[model samples]
Target: MFFSLIFSLCCVTAWALPQYQPQYYSFSPTVGRGHGESFASVGEGRITGVRIWEQSNSYIKGFQLKYENVWTPIYGSTSNEETELLLFEGEAIVQISGKYNPPNYIYCLRFVTSRGRSLIAGQPTGNSFNFYPVDGQSELQIVSGRSDGTGIASIGAHWALIYRNDSKALT
Candidate 1:
């Protein structure tokens, strides 16, 4: 009887304690129109590089992400200039900042990595936004958003740890 009482108390105590929930992912609020468009880099692999096509003095035209060795299809149209950022081993994107005009159109973007390296593109001329991991233990795992045929109209980011595989490590 005493053991049963003790077990009940233990169960109650445990139940009353805060549950530890592991965060698998966190998402930054979608910035821009975020309509009629979608792209995701999640579940493909770790992001090894970023490519942004931008019209000089204007909005971001399109972008693509390199997952390990493979590059995803560009989300928008190619433009006058293209900027690419390659991430070093053990590095991950931790922050993304950008500007978006009213209605639609992402004007500029900046990607900051864990190693303090940053890649900036497009023309900075609109409402500004900053995105980072909410849990602080995650990195950029997914890049999804909307794009008009001509340019990027909206964007969002998902944060989480990438699945590790030594063979697929970036060159």
Candidate 2:
């Protein structure tokens, strides 16, 4: 009887516990687009996992990666049906709902879709975004600096990745 109780407790604890997710992170508008670069700047230390939401033809699609926070492409081969349930598993560094670029810091991520369309997420018509609708676009990119192209390091056009964060450690 005690052994069974212990087993049940362990199962409950595992299901109830929360996973490790970054407290601060940004999403790249470029994710989910056909093929383009979008940079989302995140603090060197605060970023742990980045979930770049993919968009195509005005529809939110599948996820690029489960847990990753680097200015790189979180490539994932998925279908278009995933758009209705756009999400990042567990917790992540940032949620790229669309068009919401972080100031002074960007988190660049690569994204592309089988369908070619100009992807733009977020409430372009309204302020204070509460959600990102299903949409598709050609490409998207999250910047690491100001909203406008001004001050901030760059590799040229956009996107700068040093390596893949497999361990999910912050810099």
The TM-scores, one per candidate, come to: 0.81, 0.20
Q: Write the per-residue lDDT of candidate 2 for residues 1-171, one digit (tens) a residue.
A: 999999999999999999884322223333222232324433332223333333332222223322134433333323332322222322122223233232221223222222221223212321122222122211122323222222111211122232335563211
Q: How well does model 2 score by local distance difference test?
A: 0.29
Top candidate, metric TM-score: 1
Model 2 earns a TM-score of 0.20
Clashes of each: 0, 43
Please, what are the lDDT tens digits per residue for candidate 1 over residues 34-85? 6655766544667779989998889999988887788988888897699999
What are the lDDT scores of the predictions, listed in order?
0.84, 0.29
Q: How close to the true structure is residue 149 of candidate 2, measured as C-alpha lDDT? A: 23
